[model samples]
Target: MDGIHINENLMRRIVRSIDKAIADDIPQYLREHYKETNNAIIQLRGDYINENLRNLVVGGDIEFVPFKRYVWQGRIIVDRAEKITYTITTQKTLRAVPRKQRDKPHFLQTLLYIENGGYEAPVKQMTLMDLFPFEAEALENDYNSIVEGLIDPAEGYRHYVIAYDAEGSELRDVQLEFLDKDFNIIETASLNEYIKPDFARLTDVEPVDEDFNDETDGEAKGLVTIKSGLRPKLRDVQKQA
Candidate 1:
């Protein structure tokens, strides 16, 4: 892999587009569907952003690719020149940003480690390997043979989590995290804090439970659930490097 490279100017443009979606699209959607449950609201918000991000008008050679294959499918923003693919995910946060992964790992989540962090030696793999080895093996076997044709094959991947408050009224934070081969978060950035340096870190936030699971959403702690033969198992089309 060529390694992850961040283009600050392009990142700013992408972040601004997401901000607009949160500020404009979300409120409009909420107004239309006011009686939805909290979990339903989460899905609604995610679907709205996922759909609108494709229509985002961030100029230059950057492109957004939508993968409609698996259950973990979503759109990935790509900077052709930089050869970096940005994976977007949404989460509800007690703090300003998402600090933990799901109780059960998703295939795309696993691919993020392989891309940003490299599928190197065992001692270098992400901490998830030790936490959920059985599920990891299942996910690894389910990886498909398909590949997304790109102008330039991606060298690395970046994760962008759009975290919202529990009430779903506001976007608590938007974070860009860089990971190393050891699965440790090496750096973090947020456009909100970038534009305004004193953007309230929310240190008074409640302590987070690392084993967070939503009974309402029916996400239980077990083997990684995969919708295997239903779709051509695509581990990550963007990780061509």
Candidate 2:
């Protein structure tokens, strides 16, 4: 990907349009890529910002922060009220979780921080809800079979849901919301310490667990749980040179 230096001109045009102060969770890299514009791939970052901005504004809403580029499926969540607007940058803000994997807790924590360390009760009580077909076949002996469905349903079949919580969090405390066919709403179970610069440095994003049946419940443990698939890790990014 070394050949992939971002086009600078696009970044300028795009940056001039977004609300960066409120969208701090958005990576600054977008400002670089948005220096130019592409007509063909409007859904590309350029298009996303423009489209999201256009749609939100048409509905009498406005962007409180600048637009950002997301390497994942889910990115920003906008909430507005009379005379005031704010943006929530969630964990999915990084990119996306691997197939069947999710980035809920991290997203929630990020949202909480962006909202000043406290969120509405509805946002706080949310949890991860899976959309993939649930089956028992893909499960590692049904460790959480009762509350969660199997990874696959048929014998040697798998249809299921798998959720991971922060060290001090729990499954029962979480609330679920049906956002749509493709997306599920996850509310934070509660509030915790706000993330500071030191805590940000402590961000230890881990690698995706390639082995689904590693007898370890598909967790690599200790990762931020939300990461970019298209981008390299800091170490990996530096080593490319």
Candidate 3:
């Protein structure tokens, strides 16, 4: 568990393995484009160590910046008219607590894309886990099979909407309204406005417990108990295993 004891060579090997897996799993269209570029499939690779660890007496604590071992970049021609460049970043970390009492490292990936000349706005981004079934499964299972699970592309799209609606984002003014079965408005809010302190205060004071008649509270209590009581023991058992 000591970060100082981390094997840089092992980490590098793991990164290379994942990179190869990603390259091998790439779609034929993307691979053809990559071949056209004549550039290495993996364009960049680096390690990140926690700088704060230097100031502490316990110097073993370290964190990989970007939270991943390496990053890859390349371009793909979607059609004869347009070419899209993409960056893929990966993370491999030893989790303090692992799922199902399995003490395996966690793997995560992010994908970003932009047109060659379209830099006016930020790059379109999504998690690899949020892609369509074939792509998502390919990326998730590419390496050592440590991925947690797949997330629906719809969820990723919702996340993009929320992020884009934040202050300073292009869609800040976009409002989303939730409706009930009868078409009655259940809630209406803008993402940026919803995060304001005033908005939080207003929403926090709602009589949620009264509205749900203790059912919500009971569910919350159950969740809290599971988190506090079962989670740590599972982690400990995982470590032992």
Task: Summarize candidate 3's per-residue lDDT along 126-209 as a digit string, tens digits.
Answer: 322223322434433432222122222222211110011211111122232222211122343333332222212122212112
Q: 9-76, model 2: which lDDT tens digit per residue?
A: 21222222232211222233344445454232222332344444443232222222332224433222
Q: In order, how many clashes per candidate?
A: 0, 38, 0
- Candidate 1 per-residue lDDT, tens place, 58-176, comes to 23555666554445345566555455556555432212112345554443454444454443332333354455443545444333221244422244444433332212333445666
Model 3 residue 45 distance off true place after TM-score fit, in angstroms: 22
| Winning candidate number (lDDT) | 1
Better of 1 and 3 by TM-score: 1
Which pairs clash in the backbone of model 3?
A: none
> What TM value does model 2 have?
0.21
Give the Å shift of residue 208 in candidate 3. Answer: 19
- What lDDT is reached at residue 194 by model 2? 19
Q: Model 1 clash pairs?
A: none
Q: How displaced is residue 139 in candidate 2, in Å?
A: 35
Number of the top TM-score candidate: 1
Arranged by TM-score with the best first, the candidates are 1, 2, 3
lDDT, residue 185, model 2:
31
TM accuracy, model 3: 0.18
